[model samples]
Target: MNAPPEDDLSLGQPNVPATYFKDQRVTCEKDLYKSLPPLINGKAGYQSLLPDHTLVDTSNHADPNSEKGAKIRPDLGHYEHGVVSEEHPTMLDLIILAYEVKKARKEDIVNDTMKCTKPLPHDDCQAPYENTCQTSTITRGQLANYATQICRRQHRTHFYMVFIFHPFIRFIRWDRAGAIVTKRINYVEDCTPLVRFLYLFGRLDRAGKGFDPTVQPASQAEAEEAKKYLKRWEPKLERTVFKMDVPAANGKMRQFLVWGSLADPESPLGRTTRGYPAVEVIDGVVSAKPVFLKEQWRSVAVRPEVETLKELNEHGVLHVPTLLCGGDLPGQETKTHEISIGNWRVGHKRIDKRIHTRFVVAEVGQPLENFPSSKVMLGAIYNAFQGHDQAYNKCKIWHRDISGGNILILDNNKGLLSDWDLAREEADLDNGARAHERTGTWPFMSVGLLQQPNKQHTTRDDLESFFWVILYYGLHYLPHTHRDSLDHMMKEIFDQYDFAERDGMARGGNNKDALVRRGRYLGSRRSQQFSFIGCQPLTEFLFDCLDLLGKWDFRYDPTIQSWEEDGYIPASHAEMEPLWRQALQSPLWPVADRAVDQVRLSKRLDFIVRGERPERKGSKRSDPHDSIQDDEDDDDECSPRKRRKTCHGSEAAHL
Candidate 1:
């Protein structure tokens, strides 16, 4: 059969002859370039540029498949003539447009020579890319950026080809709307010829049909099936209700709501959004080998918890939901793409960033907007703290961003520390100080991290964030008649914690007072919890936690008779554990004694509020000795001097 016209991009639609893809006598790399049809505009001459921006190859002489048109012609594609060259005089202009060209360092000759001496054992050279010799590959984001640069420079959509290797190519159509699609094509017998012709013609097959990159799951029925499968996997997921498509960091996302199980249906999980369950369906092409991707980091940080929680729950030491599920999305080809710039990797590429789509089922709980607390709050947060300690010390994963939303209170009054997206391995920490971007929720960040944004974050910072979480919620959410005072205190706290702005201006100015220590009242607010004074032990716990924060805030600059004056003792988990235990043991601590039915505790508190004597079975009064104290008489109970003497003495003894 006669070959389809060279300009026809739809060669695949017809029954292409087997001879069409038969190998011809290839002379040099230039012959391969020429054999391919002109892709940009109507003119020909395509060249592959190396990392150094040098023309690696541009010879265009067709042999057999593209033997008809073999001359090097001028490029009149979407990009203006000369825009394709790395040294195109407008290169600096491109960089200004944010198309950064990050060059990889040259390989070490001695090490590379030593490596190639013999056939490397499969185990020895398992990660050949890890060797110093490999040139750093660019990412799709980088391609998108460069395409954007071309578009901005020319004021029009530009069709660009990013060649990772001969058989691997990314077809990019960039414009004001962004990349139409970053299509990765792998060379195969029949398809290779068609891909070559399509690129040469500057048109993807079905060109008039607008390119839609938004991933539509093969079927909503299949997605629904996936949800049902997850519901079966974890019986806690009741039913998914609302779903909306959203942009994903790594893939297309479909965010859906599920009806989740209460932490403890029998016990009262205080202040929960019971009907709302968090479910996200991440759907995208599976685009890399599992071994060579940063998805492993997420696996390391998130997974193992399913089994770890099982083990911890069995032992009765740490308790949390076996919440995370969904491995690789099923029913997709395991295709691999080149390492590209995405959320995980920005400037440099170390490993492949796989685009994954899966159903992420997790517990959704109350937000901290106007959250109220009970005695169970103490125990719940304590257990949640223990959960963090377990994840850090036992699992070797640190929850870097522990803010209000990251934790949830279950129906049973159990607190679950969640949202491990910012969690990192202890090993990755050796890479040096963290960037300011990873400073978690700005309000919950530690003073040191807030003040010196580039400083290395430690577990101490996370602990401090947790401290702020408790204080912020406790101060703002406590049901007190002093609404005016609470509002003022809330404004004060928000001012101190809002690191992004100051007195109204962005903190971009070098204002020394903007530092956390200088801006806020540290120990002053503890005295303001007038209503909570009757809960003496709880008050003491709060003071002690604040004391630790105060010491940590000025850890380096010690006072004349400071806690660390005689011996420099930095805050550690060991010191905090006793405080958590003390908080748990408080009579006012919620869940000190849990009821199968949570309403009983509410009734007990209600009866106590009414100043009535208990009259019914199981109508228990909590801490009966404290009944006479009212908010009016509670001032003396919460006196800073008294709390300092008692709580400080206990903390010192523990130290």
Candidate 2:
């Protein structure tokens, strides 16, 4: 058979051999023979390497008949011939083994080192962790000793920060209206840690709200539930209420209404729109001035004038009622009448009288006869001063308008210091430069305060007014002759002492006549005797109080120290001892008894130390029968002991 031509193959056709060709003889070619396809010696062409048929081996490879095959031996270390020997574990194996050894050794080394060396200072030292400790125990003890000094320094820095940055912060959020409504809950479990802590500690109730001091305890389950809720929302409702700045619609006017009745209903003097005269509550009860009205006189003149009166009242440090609400009196009117109770106005009416344009209604308080005894009054005053000091520390400005009319008597025989219309921010203390004239009631106004129209009013002026009020309360008369108006009083004070002089009266030369005249007026028979005249102990107490004020320099001395240091004593030593002793003496003592006894004891001590002994009219041996006569006269006076008995017994209970 002949192979097909390449071209024929390409065309996909078979080619016929040329052996039977009719027109041509066959030509023998050696090359052509050599080119013929070669035959296979062993197998056919294009055969697969796999055998076609299987060969049966009678001797199995595992049979003993086969030399190459032997019974399978369980030789663990058998070596095969011609096969590459598995060389005794390569360098990698030795390296891995070495690594294992090194790892074990490293662990051992670590363990040994740990054992050899001491534990870390934090662990070994039983004290606080040294690494994170801020101070050693010794250092902390030293710091404790100087805590006050450190606090003072820190406080100075804090004050600087507050003064400099607070205004800016305030401006940023000044317009923000605080939360309007709030709900109080005892405690909630979902509350934050702080809320939970507060609730757990009884600081907050079960609803996670601030705990009311008067509230009674709740059941355990309710408390637990409250804790759970407290965690959900930290109720700061009470705090928010206090922080909320309730907007005052009118510019500066605030109105108030005190609800209570004065002891003397006939004398409507102390009646205020918000207080006693308008409304009658039980005596000695905690009465509230529910209504409030405040008026900010728009005109600069009116405001300044009113502010002057307010400042004078403040200066005298008189107790005034809080201002609740006020505005321009109704009608296009220039005249109005407002009743002032204590310092607050209860009601305001537009009166027909031109001179008395504004009528403010104030609640009437107790009569002078029902007023707190001298000791109680003194204590209240002291408390007021302390409050003033606290206000100063807070950088709050207080313009106390102290005056005879502003003072009031409470059923409890205590005085409440009220009113804040004239009060300015501490930052406004230097605003005196804006005013053209003195801005306070004349009699209480300091000399400098009167002369320097723009001179900043300092706390010193307030102290001077306090002195005047104290004198008035003791003597039942003004230090100077009564002037018809505020202006007249101002003029008199200025004329008597040249305020322009740096030294005030001291530098201008002592006006002894003025002092003596004032003294005489107070001592004169024409002066009205207060109801407590027979109270010799009270009289002596008043004298001692006067002495404390007299020792101080009332003028605006630029070099004066803080009020606490130079002007007032923080602790009333004489008063405290007796009260403390009394408190310890009777644990089950009635509140009224305690209060009265404390007052009486304090007064008695005061009298013994300062009061003048009564003169014996006739030199006669003391008679037992005469003792009752002496007692009658003594009882007329304000005796601390009598006061105690009255207070502890039915007197307080009756109210």
Candidate 3:
């Protein structure tokens, strides 16, 4: 450890003058609060070092009010000075660090997690080692949970965690790229390292403190200006207003005022897409018309959404959200990928590096599920399909992530395909690269892609995703008859996954694959199908669409392939192209443009679709077909949905 604060030697910490930590005696995890608070609060060094902050121990915190899972309480937190309340529980702004403590030594706690990113032999995957020590596994999970909770509660670029084991301390810095853990420091003999770290943490500015600088409080006037055109969502707190600066169409920095409460996902990781209906601030004047503003984190290697949107606009792709402006937020990217603690380098299979990104679209539309009538929903979906087709055929852009959330309905009820962050150009991605990273939303991702984790994303996968999006909204609103078994069906097909022993990732494609393989997309009886529903036209349209393309979902068993005698053809854009055509000529249209019944949607979403989310939905049995299944590529008889090369694995975190 470094010398005590009185060492008077210049040490390379963030802040200049060195401050000392109290020599508080502690034995185990329980004693950390009692012994350490003095170093942060009044008596020890709190006032002199971090006058504006206080360390609050909330290890047992429970928020009964939050419907969004148990508020994961960090053992201790460095927060802006104040008493913690249910409303401002974790201090959403100005967070210094989140701390977790394990009674065990640093080795026991840290070694619990496997270095999946290490350059290890493919056959010798480290995943099985995670089960070697049960306690260490639990501790690793807890540490990741704490880090994730902190990231969710606060809008931040990255955050820090102080993992303590009495004498030993490890500093973990977390970003979208993953985590960078420092070697352990023994703080029992000399407390300077912990003291100096905390002192400098308080000294750093807002960004240095890990808050997102792109977000700032909106003025009362700006908030009022945005409220006129923007719709609102009820957030945990009385909605806070904020203004974000993004690159405008004119190549100038412009401000957009967001009135609605920016919603955080249940898990504060991944794209964490924060979207809003915003109005522009131009020359001290707010625009009368509103636009859509979306902010999300995306891989640096992935093509920018703006470039794809501009490409679509240039090729005159139909039904796509019109690109106005916006690009990668300069100088705002993850810092964790650069950090590798010897054995743990960042993995390239998932996200290598992520950058904060912002963009605006001219159309301010409602979500796809909010369609007033069945025909409108069909039209919107049909329009989105056309947009996808033109983008693929004309511009050679593949929109990888197709979900109910990504489709929107305009005032005229035409569907607009949005959320192109994961879209890629065919030229740039001949193999549909980053299969693990930018693959679309979970429920809607093609079963083929989900089944074969390393599968290169293909147009066929996108087409399958399109079908799921339609079925998702259809099952929710079209009044399907499979009531008693709806919950089980949804859970199995959409949520079920088996941990691929090959890569150690949850790949839930068996049921979805079985759904197609058995021709059981719908049930057997009339009572099992969506018959005599209010949205009969929509139901009919869906069946027609499914029959045309879903037939191609046949399992491609290469062992029994015919050399032209069977006349088998792999799935292609030709089969899916008809859905868009049928949608255009679709005689049935909704009686009127209608908004979604939020209450109804919410209830069914939890019940039928998510199966009310059990303590854990009973896992589907592992498939004997662990071999990379194929969907049969037209040109190259490759594995399902054109599998990408095997994974180093991807995503938020596995631990």
Candidate 4:
């Protein structure tokens, strides 16, 4: 927690109020805020927010999976804390975008890594990229960390940042696409731009401040109704009691009193998804049945989740999450791409469009690990397989991202396939207008997909992913016979991902690929791979999976480009169906867990996405949370956490 006696930008009590600091010798960060004049509200047609002193502290809001917890603090933050807006019909607690500031010397912070010539060349900079500057690299990571924290707290289109390197100050705008940074402006020469920006920012309303206008604060009565449903929100997250208004063309508006989401993204970009426990409120009365509310920024290149769910539900697909209401947030497209930073070539190379989308489903359930017995686990997985097969064959919608996170267990112990946000329709895929894109959780992704970065998702891949999801669940919860270190064993067996230097793309599954192709479980220390204690049915079921699909020998033969080009088609859903069903009717039921551990199942999904073992005390490896590092790099460009910063962005010295 931050030590208080803090002053906010909107309203602060500075001891020495100085309007401009040009020639002043301000050495400390505290002095810079203590003496600077704030942008007091109602000054220029409504300059409400002011500048004050408060370190950008995010001690409480750690990634739930993180063991040591998130320990990050920027030099300063210009924010509105919490403002309740009564201007609209529904009282709204708008999603506020906080501006970050970092104190640094001229040598550390930069806009680009390469040196510019006197007369800029038409092609790339002739000088070698100054990529080895450690201070500059760490500063960029720090900025990313701050942006990630803010985005987790609120839904935003894009947010701004103030990067100061003493005499030189740079303005940066970050979004899902990437960051747009302005060239260095020597604040020592003139402070007008900085002052004008702060003053102008104060005059803007909630929407102008980058907060979602449609998300309003829930009234006292609505809050009470929500408490009856959800037990309690994440202690790390601020309890969000709010209303979501999804606009409809037929004059019918949708509203839900959302309590909290499943998990928050660790990074500022990508599909920042949250599964909310929500209840409908029509004509001021809360509905009896609670619903599952999903909010995410869908890539404009892909189809919307609402369309996929609606089509599947209409087609009578079984075991899929039932769709209720879903749509795109009106006029809520990402604005980072539209921004132009002259002379800075930051955000153009791969600027993918992202749209804010919301959808509601009638049913909600626990995750896969919540199952009490092996019987329930097998039954659930088999039924979920049924849903996947049905969707692929009947509705022609393939479940591309088949991870443990997407598998849900209903009140009746039946399995349901969730999170079709990444699903691709067969018709659309066959059309050939769209390019094949890689998607799925790393730990649970198919070996073939992981091995070949350019390969497209196939039903055979989904079947393998489903099997991996089951295996991952079993290893963590069920009793196992691997007598070695569990953490080390997991790290080696999962064979999650590691970045390749040539292209900066993630690669894994070499071990897993060898396992299936050669029929040997490859572990570094022990040859005795897996032996489930007291569960022969489960063990037999897993071993049988080796024979389910014939090996395609996806070895890269530099000669013929790719295996797909070599005319090798993936196995259909039907080919893997018989094995899944037979496992369900195994002679021995799925064994019940010997002892329930204290660890939660939801964090395990994070394990899959992070792709790194959860390092802790007594482990051979150094703990990751010891410093602020971006080990997260996704193959989809906007992949989940565990990356290296490689987006198309230029860096220049602020000085």
- Model 4, 175-246: lDDT tens digits are 765677776776667766666556555546656666677788789988788767655332233466788886
Model 1: lDDT of residue 47: 33
Worst 10 residues of 3 by lDDT: 646-655
Estimate, for each residue in 157-212, the C-alpha lDDT of model 3 and write its tens digit: 87888888766788877776566666567776666777677766666787876777
TM-score of each: 0.43, 0.30, 0.78, 0.78
lDDT of model 2, residue 416: 48
lDDT-based ranking: 3, 4, 1, 2
- Estimate, for each residue in 278-328, the C-alpha lDDT of model 2 and write its tens digit: 211232232233222222212222233234333434554333443322233
Please give the lDDT score for candidate 1. Answer: 0.37
After superposing candidate 1, which stretches have Cα over 4 Å from the reference?
1-317, 320-324, 328-354, 357-372, 431-437, 480-482, 485-488, 495-537, 556-568, 588-655
- Model 2 error, position 533 (Å): 7.2
lDDT score for residue 38 of model 4: 36
Ranking by TM-score: 4, 3, 1, 2
RMSD of each candidate? 20.9, 44.3, 8.3, 9.7
C-alpha lDDT of all candidate models, in order = 0.37, 0.27, 0.61, 0.60
Candidate 1 per-residue C-alpha lDDT over 616-645 given as tens digits, one digit per residue, 9 for 90 to 100: 642111110010001111211211111101
In terms of TM-score, how similar is model 3 to the real structure? 0.78
What C-alpha lDDT, on a 0 to 100 scale, does residue 417 get in candidate 1?
66
lDDT preference between candidates 1 and 3, better one: 3
